[model samples]
Target: MSRRSEEKLAERADLMVEEEALRDLAAGGSGLVGLDGPGAGTAAKSAKAKSGGGRGGKEKDPARPRQPYVPARGWPGAGGGRVGYMDPPTMWRATTVQACGMWPFAAGSGSPMTGVPLGQHLFTGATVCGDPLNWFTRARYISNPSLFMLGMPGLGKSTLVNRMLIGLAATGVVPLVLGDLKPDYADTVRALGGQVISIGRGRGGINVLDPGAMGEAAARIGGDAGEVLKAEAHGRVLNMVAALITIVRGRPMDDHEQSVLSAVLHHLRERTPPGRAVLLPDVLRVLTEGPDRVRAVTLDRGSDTRYRDAVDPLHRSLLGILDGPLGDTFASETSTRIDANAPAVCIDISGIGEADTQLTAAAMLAAWSDGLGAVAASHALADAGLAPRRWFFTVLDELWRPLRAASGIVDRIDALTRLNRSLGLGDAKITHTLKDAEALGTDADRAKARGFVERAGMVVCAGLPKTEMEDLGKVVGLSRREIDLVSSWSSPPGWGVRGEDDEPPGRGRFLIKVGGRPGIPIKVAITDAERELHNTNTRWTTNEAAVERAAARIAREVARPAQEGPPPALAGGPAALALPGDPGFPAVEASAGGWTA
Candidate 1:
């Protein structure tokens, strides 16, 4: 009720009076309101009357009709509004303008609780989900540059790997399983698809393949099977000797020591007339030319002349046998072509000691990689003779450290990584700890594991204990949220993620990192159909096929009368039988005791 308040009230009253006059004038506003010039101002203000002014100070009727604004029933034109905000983010796929903050919906899942909204019909032919993105088709195993599967025991890794490989092989994709497994795995592989090697026992290796005018496999070995074996064995032996020396010395030998050993081995193989290779000729060539020569030239300068003299003769004899006898058998033998698109080739070195495992692992990995590389190269090769082959991921499971003896895995990783990509092959290596990986390098380099994980393009971490999770986080560059996903405390089948809508990463859940694309967590399809197609668990029932075939054959024969017509009938019906109580025909089912008879 102060002066300012009174003035505001007075002003409001005047405004109402003017509004009334304006309305009244508007009804028939043409005449008086159009007074000329100065007079018009006076006419316009005719209703600007205060509470009481001039003509009367007495209060007007309290309930006098007062003009009210129609559209003006809005905010008062007094002060400006204070800034305000919107509500919290509640629904997924909700609008951003009215949002509080968003939490990730379940990533790449179709579970009622976790499934994120999909666009529609992206995967045209896929039948699983109704998502428009067509995740099934787009995320298929074929589309990926490579697929990698890693799991703890009983997680069904090998089961799926073998099954899927077999199925693919049957498609004429060519499947070759080179791993440290007994005949059972091979048998299972064969049962699902392509032929398997019979090297172990009678199962026999793959039959000689018609490489279809592509002598690619033969070219690698130079001439025949013995040559290939010899080359592989030589590399393996050299690798083994290196590991043995490393184990004995507690360290890798210096360049000089290596040189001396090489010289001695070389001297024995070449200085004598018996040095002509009788077995693995290719291997003998590689050994004598580069390896032993380098050693002889370098180490002979020191006190290693005696070493060379002793080992040289035996080396030559072995090389000669490898060149002659060994080469002959392999030359006449045939080759087997397995699938070039397997997801894994498990190289189990369980029985071997840590030192020997290094040699075997290196040699085997090298061989598989070379084969895959050859396949891929053949495909991309511009030559008309070369057909591009589809290569897949080469995953190593149950990876063991070579007892601080073998050598730097970094070198192997580097070589493999280069070759893997060149041949369209991916490498997924599984190890228990970061330290274990670190130990595989000879130079005590810390970045060995880091370099590997970084180059892998995709790194999937599962069942990580807390401590190991922390350690992995440091090297893997995973964020706090991503680390949480990896170290999830939830039981199997839960998933955790960090990006847009994070959740617990669970069993059958995997995160893919494709080049520069965002990490996509996927709920893999583990259905029976998928398993049957990918892993080859579905067996062909010969009995059922045979039954159908037999029925059809029998029907056709019966309808046409295979005997040209019906057999002789009982001439006078039942009375025509010569024997008194003879049945015209015997039971076919029981005839001669079996169908064949």
Candidate 2:
């Protein structure tokens, strides 16, 4: 072509070729410039399907009609809908103990299996058990074989005590519930063929001057140690009596008065025969009479007057104990003996009330002293290898009330705690809180009381108030986490709720702090019969049938005048009275259902 005409012709020719290629691509010919690759036709089909169009050739397929895109709506801003991936801010650092504490599944090693099986651990399914005496003698996991339990009422504190005592009893370890507020131990005592000494008006009494405890004290400490322990035992009894005076007098004992009381107890101990139980009346006799040789001993008449002054207050104090509400319970000889080998020897002090603090304190002290003696006797047997190394568990139930009631109560408790070690005894102090210990008289008294908490080899705590939990931590060396754990235990998830939600700490649930081990949550369980026997929820329910029967019998007797004629000779034996489902009468269980139409 000529210059300009040739170029125009060339451009027209190029346009024609491009137009042909576009027409072919529109017809899915796959012959376009970039569409000529090996997988070019497959890619074309994918694009055609995505655009809602029909494909071409063997791979041809009908594309589904596309729906218009609609965005989800919510609170405005980019925060709506599925969120975008965001980077983590930072990694937190924590120690293993701290880390594990945050997570319940993570727990430290369990307590050594040195004692009786108590219960299953709350976190792990491992078995948790503890016996202070066992831990003490082994010298492995614990320092002392004393236990302190803190929990609210109805949290199974006393019930757990009963279980421990009975469990030990089965192992040939004698058990003694020294002071019982709920008094549930009585039935257990009776069931185990043990005696239950109930101290109340017209009930069995304890001879405070009984030599059994002293004798055991002497045996537990042989030779010079025994002499020292014997003297301690003597002093304990004297102090115990003095505390009783202080409780009754509503104040602490004067120095001179205390001396006079001690001298009187000493004289009574010397004069009383070993075979006879030294009664409170005997001590009372000494206090009032002031000894026959007292006049000769005094160098001056003023000395006699001073002696009189000391003796008068003590004598008056003695009179209150011997003639007050406790008179019937303590003035006479003990009706029951301390059988060291018995399964249990419970002193039912439930009859003694808060108003009768003096009586309760005196009764508890007496029972505790007597229990120590029994434990001592058992130890002697165990030492000779005559017995299977028997030990005793001495339980101090509702320890706080009596602790607050008397001035010398802490001293008596301290003595018991000390003497128990040598006497083959494990002391368990059952109370609500550590504050009870701190509530003693002076700072020194409070410190002494606190010693009980510290000396305890194991601490079993249940749900406690936040304040009480903190107080417990401070007094007994509980960690911050432990205090939080205990306080949280105050109420479990959905506690006291109905249905499956009712996850309250029903019974025997406690946080056990043993030696240096981490806190272990435990749930103590027993058989149905054991539950019935150990049910100490006095305020909730009781032996309704027995109570009703008693009331009915009393009513009948009151209504029907007695014209005394052999007093209606028994038609049937004692069995007839208690027999369930008799011919004419329904059983207690049936009667418990209430009057039937």
Candidate 3:
């Protein structure tokens, strides 16, 4: 046959198959392919008869008894060609971006098999996996190794991180939990045979100013050896003290107060023994009588008085830290040291309950600083060609409290966030909300706080309420489709039969946005063994019930005293009264007959 005739025959064959399918469908048949039976053929013939057609009867010329009313069996038998369908040429109108997005499957676009295995991609069944450290190290990938995870509580945020950390640990990446407020990671850490440092008053201590770590940190940064080491030690101590004092005073440090703190740390660095830690008591004593007193000769009378004034308030603030709930947590030397090469370490701050945000922030700072120093030391030793590995991960769970403690504390956090690359640290900050940025004291602090999230290499965000999507989109640069998918991943408004035993959609599901790349929705898939070890889901359990009851009882106890009488004045003790007329530190008093004096 001619080529044109061959094409015409193929088209006829495809038409015949489609006609047979239509007939079967119209006759209340499934139209399923590859079926052969008497009932199917009868159904096809009956439908063709209803349509007033009988095996192309008009072309048959009334030949051979009209083929005994037999239906077409298959496409090749129905027509004359060997194969069934020959589809016509077709094209879809779409932009390059849209077309590229739709090739094969939407989720199959640009997902590489790198880093640790996360889970299956939402749209496509392809595996989606990436680590912040791996992405940061790759050329032109992510700029920073910091990451943020935001989700509602009990929606697998903690559980997901637990899985990721475990995966990273398996790959020789050490996971250090900077602050575990809920104390949920202890089981995972223990299961991995890692260390858990319980940080609280008297339960354990984390000396924020451990000279040994500070000295090692100095050695790592590569400076004029001992002097560089001492200067580094002084700076670390200064940062810790300034942040602590700011938290204690509920404000930023003034110039003279900052100057006094610097001087005191400098003096302590010079006077302390080689291996002694810089305790808060040492800082308090130096603040009271060291620099301002020694520098008295250089200052004129008014300046001297101002110096004395700043010194006393600074002294009281430092004194409060030495005497407050955090004193035992950070005053002495660290009882348990986080090894630089340990597979995992979890600093449990659950001992400091919700009532003490300040204590929680302080302990976090101490532990994080210590961990940073250790990691830096490891990196330095690697530089010196002595260490086995040079990377570590710092997981900051419940990160908001420390970020919102004070502006100075935010500065410290920014420093750590910026140094993530050089020190080989991948900081994964976990939080329930992003409002912690707005809770900062100043616009600058808020911007810095948000900038930390902005600079992250990846953000694993789960479901958020409708109201929060707009702001979250702005903060994280989520696309419209991404926001829609987030809503899809959220639980439906009402329930149905299929959903009765269905797990909440938001749990274990997350939108993973690699820096400036299309966000891939993924879930944290774990083995049964992993599920038991890293489970943080306390909801619908007896433990949850007990926690609720205890919280209620504590609330009642706290409210009963307030109901009985007015609050006592200066319950903050001398720290509230020792600001030396600084208006920033206001002192209130109760007067008789319900009047202010």
Candidate 4:
């Protein structure tokens, strides 16, 4: 035997020993590969017999075969049938402070649960609540309690604001829609049992000289607070007069002109009887009379001619507000005073034509002055403990009109935005787009207007053109995804089918951006009760007869057989379907079984 022959014989003996060990294990012996002791094999077999394969323990049948492995077809793709090697990802919720330690790299803890519950988070499917005032005073998430909302027309800008108004009203926050251009909030205000003060030609009116709720508040809150309220009320009237002059003259009043006007207003207020509101006509009368106080401010030097010349321009403008295109809207006593204690108040200026930009601007300025004065008075009374503490939600819709109407209006709104927090006011500024600010006359006005967005606690944006995203990004720090999402919402509507109205792609979608954090995209969902109140397009919408026809057409379509094909064309061309209102389409009527043409 050579060396190679001895090696082959040794390998054969080792393989035989391994095969015997495997056989013993299959017969229920210990699984240790090389262990072949009689005691080990007997112990393993006894354990296997005790632990039977059946539900109840029973002796194992040696003749029974093991169950065969069956393959499963799961989701399509490689490894689809394989069992998961690891558990699926899970979500654990915690407060922001706890989340910092748990997920240091996490983007956010989703939208805050505080504030007004607007709608669901577009991405996370979580309920998103937001309100600038609530966030500022309650959650303390933002420094300022003001919001800026911008979007395109017909995209539910007014609807979203109405939602916040309704929510805040429920939370005991009064909603004051200072200037409702399209009367968008009138119905909602009425439904909320609020005051809807209309101001337009042949409609209602607003007396610019009236102190509104401030007078009552001042009397109720006597002492230093009362004096402060009176002073603030006086200042508001002065500012409103100045703003109106600026609008009419297409230029702001000079220092001397403002002084003369202020002096005239003061004289008029002094002579007015208690509980009697001042009117614009009274101010004009005082200026005409050349009172000593007015003359001193104008530096007439005791010359009647000098006094008249000094106030000639101011007189003409005030006269224009009374008798010009503005008509009796501002000259007469206010038709309906704003009820500060009401759930909401909407100054509907939509009765004014859209072409009358200047008049609209003046009306807006006056409404804002009156509304804010009421807010200030409310705060003063609450502080004095003479009235219940109340929070006001101010809606400044069609913001561009006022900014463009008068440059002075910008300064007024700027001051309001700054002092909103201290005054217990949550301001919401709504406009078509950011470009509206850029369209202002002067660079200073444009910059100040843009600050409205910058200083806001949060910016809620709706369907806007791609062109708007560039300018909006500068103020809101929008990410590419957010920009794309917002721009996508501006897509045009698709063709209507089955007698349904064609809705805009981004009708109720909004992106709420706060600071540099990721945006919260929300789709506003209105309740059934709000459906009729939220319709801002009543002018362009179909009449009742057309609506009934549409309803019948829809009923016919629903009852029609699914297998029914398109109607035949007039000629031997491709079959064409007749639209609901098409002339050739047949009228639908109800039958015993269903609707029929």
Candidate 5:
């Protein structure tokens, strides 16, 4: 456009703003143009007189200002009232700009004040940039550093992730899975070209990290605990390790350096002992590999440093993990050709409980962290622009369990959130119990979890119990009436998907958020084996040991019913669903002593 055209547009915009301001003054005392008293009107007139114009020679009615804007503070709602915002002569559309650029602010549209476009959001896998919630439309969100996924059994946390992989597989972005419980699903992941090693399973498998491991790993190089590491102070060490990793990037601690750390830990143990300690395999790996293994680096002077140069090389490795075999291994798969496709990876955690959850989660987190570090160091982790298209997702169905495990897990997780994103690695954590999240991890881990939820680029809640409804309502800035919308995942199709959108239709409905919007309601699909996501549901009856146990249980309980009751329509306890069906509908026949077949 010509300069004259641009100037005309600017003038029009200014006129509109001035008109609105004067209108606001006439309408209410609280508007930006509001009058404090009758004297306020005289003051304005006097100012205009001093300027030699009542209305800038434009329109000479008794009201309205000649200038479009005038900066001043101390006004209500201008960063002074109960809920004040920045004090400035902001454009009317300023909210639109600020809303889009800021992270974790109360959800709102973009502001002209900040001039950031409130564009849709997408997920950034280790090597790709795209939307994580692809199956359900209208919930586009830019991949923020945080993501929260909640659901009950069979709620598609895994399945949807697979769809996400399919959507962005070409981007070469990949993720490191932190905690996928069902090792049986390894094949599916391998098909995606991801290199996954299960930790906490056995000796050959990655061992579940433990506090003892922390102490052992530390002492291996004959390092001192600038403070000693005690199990009782697990949480502190976990936080320290996490804080240190973010600083050190997995650099190794020299012998004397170890001693200093031990001393620092020992000092903290005496002065402020933690409730528990969680041992992270990643931390152990750093100490074992001697620090050249991990990525982030911070000198220990302020926190202490210069022990060994570990973080820089670790950062280099991260680029490889995100771009190489590990990237594919951590993703979902469609065929035996591991590199050909990337699939969403999710694990079913219906049967696992807290303390027992550590091992499984460690496995998944380990894989994910490795992949994310690689992605961040190279191409995928840039703060601006789209993630390089290659993307992979790891969905943790019951994440809180592992986080709550000994204190060591907390910092490791924070490290995941703090450092892992951007390289095409997205950690999708689904939980039934925020309380589990609240109670289990060290205070630091719990804080990290909460921080994640608060700043999530996208958040969806469905079918929550009432207490959860109340708790989340406050967290997301929802009203009491909105709280009633939450329900369980087991509910029908769209029952409780509530968030920044209109009441979504169907049972088990969910509200979807994208960059400060509550735009639409969406459905969280259930798992049917035929769907894209590989369901890691195991049949106890199908297992050799489980089959033997069920067979034995059949001998003791569940007697053959008399002629009175109808033939059982469904599968039985001792005879799990995996058993062959009596499809012929043959008449009842006895077996063994009860009756000969």
Candidate 6:
């Protein structure tokens, strides 16, 4: 019963089992059939096989039987196989305060879903809704209720503003497109059932002397508020007249002359009949006549010569406005005034050619005066409890034109930008580049003009040149990636096949930058209706069709014999002329006789 003797007996037992299993294998029998031992099951055999039978057959365990073959199964969802339905992941909304606590590990942020839905975010594909007033009043995202939009020409600056106009109008905010140089918003205003007041030569008139809605609003209220409004109306007229004179004279008026003009306007208003609008002619006539009020204000004591000499410049400037190129537009009585009840209104000044810088400048100033006067009147009535409170969305497009036209205009726009929030007005200022402000005449004017962009609640930019981005960066903070993204959009379009319309890379792409926060890049999406309503290329397309038609007509005329009789050179026979679109007719040149092949 010693330990060595017991081990020898166990070895002898293992040898006997091995001989039986090997003999059974040699007889072509199943080694695993009816196996009865400690390691005689399939699992024990599989484990031994996986261990390689103790590195060699000599050391193989006989008690464990061999395992049977079994094929491997494939994954059900692989190789385009059917898979069981999976429960979709759920998403829950939370405020920022709640989100910070609930999802403490999440990173990054997105534009808030507040204000007008302008377009989709460029990175996260989230819808971006933003504007100055909406973001300020609703979301408390920005402090200023004004927006400045800068972009290259033909880069959807006006289209973006039009989108805001359409959206804000739906929210019961009246839109006022003051001095639409390209008439970009006229269609939008009309589509919104708003009034489109055209001001140009032979189109319509806006007498700067006419108080517009302010006068009417002042007349309706009879308390101290009414007197305050009346005084405001007079100041508006005086300032308008002064602005016009500055535009015509190419310089700001002196205090003495301004006082004389102010006094004359007061006297004219007092003498004029109620319900009648004061015209520029009335202003000029009153200045020409040396009335007591005019003399008193001029400080000319019973000296008609000194009085006439003093008021001579003011008299000539008013007369110039009455008889100048803009006479038909600004000198006459008001033809059409903005309708406050309408959802939107635009002063269409596109009829005036852009080349006439002074006229454009004067008309734009007058339109601003008139538009803001109407807004002031609305507030007055609301304060008096006679009308419901109203909010206005004011758009100032081609802002540089007015600024460059008159240095004084900068002050007026500066005042408006500062007071927009208090006046219940949300305004957008649009221009080609920041240099437009920098190109102003005076240092003071340029400084004030630059403030327009600086004080904007938000800056919405489309494709802009790298140089412009540099200038813009000085006013607003922009990162390298944002700069590159914006500059890339300004790249020239690739050449396209004939008859294929090539769209600019940044046609509707915009970057909304508020303060130093991460920028929200968006690609404005326009509907078919909006595309039609906001088409700024109508002039180009129409001109192309017109040119094609003209070419065809010229070709027909040249191809046909002259009814009156051909010139002496072609009298012998009708000239052969290849019509447009004919084979080999790449172009036609006109000779003295007619269009040649």
Best by lDDT: 6
lDDT tens digits, residue span 347-434, model 1: 2223333445433443333334334433543453323343344544343444444323234444555566545544444444554455
Give each prediction's root-mean-square deviation over alpha carbons.
21.0, 19.2, 17.8, 15.1, 25.3, 15.0
Worst 10 residues of 4 by lDDT: 65-74
The TM-score values for the models, in the order shown, are 0.43, 0.64, 0.67, 0.71, 0.41, 0.74
lDDT of 6 by residue, 366-387 (tens): 8889998999999999999999
lDDT of 4 by residue, 20-100 (tens): 557666776543333333235546556566778466877664642222222231243445533424365875544567666
lDDT of 3 at 594: 70
Specify the highest-TM-score model's number: 6
- The global C-alpha lDDT for each of the candidates, from Candidate 1 onward, is 0.41, 0.69, 0.71, 0.81, 0.43, 0.82
- Residues 1-597, candidate 3: write the lDDT tens digits: 897797777677556666766776676765533435223645555656666665654332221121222333233444553444456677343445767756564434556567777777766657776778777775446788878988777677877777778878887888888778777788888888888888887689877666545476555555565456557666766777777777788776787677766766667777887656677777766645646444553243557566666467777777788787667776787788786556788888888878787887777777767777667666655665655765777787777777765456577678878877877778888887677678776889888988877777788888877556668888677788888777665664356667555567787788888666788888666678877776565544477777899999999999998789986787776566766456556656766667542
**Model 1 RMSD vs true structure:** 21.0
lDDT of 2 by residue, 412-508 (tens): 7887777666665778888887777777778888888878877788888988988998777765667888777777767755644455645455446
Q: What's the C-alpha lDDT at position 22 in model 4?
A: 72
Instruction: State candidate 3's TM-score.
Output: 0.67
Badly placed stretches (over 4 Å) of model 5 are 1-145, 183-187, 190-196, 200-203, 206-369, 376-394, 419-424, 479-482, 488-508, 524-533, 540-597
Q: Report the C-alpha lDDT of model 5 over 1-597, residue by residue, as the tens digit.
A: 997786667666556655766765675422343334223455666655666674455443466543323333223333442212446574232344666665354544331111112212222111112254332222334455345766555444555444444334434435434455553334555566555443332222321122333333233323233123324234433333333332223233344444433443343334333433322323333443433212122343332134344243433443343343333322122111112123433232223334443333433444433333333322322222322334445555556656654444555556656554533455566666567767852566677777767766666665666677677766766554445554533344444456443332323344454554442344434334424236456543256887789898986566645435676666654445443455543356767678533
Q: In candidate 6, how many Å is residue 60 off?
A: 52
Pick out the ten consecutive residues of candidate 6 with the lowest summed lDDT. Answer: 69-78
Could you tell me the lDDT of residue 134 within candidate 3?
71
Judged by whole-model lDDT over C-alpha atoms, candidate 4 comes out at 0.81
Runs of candidate 4 exceeding 4 Å displacement? 1-109, 494-502, 545-597
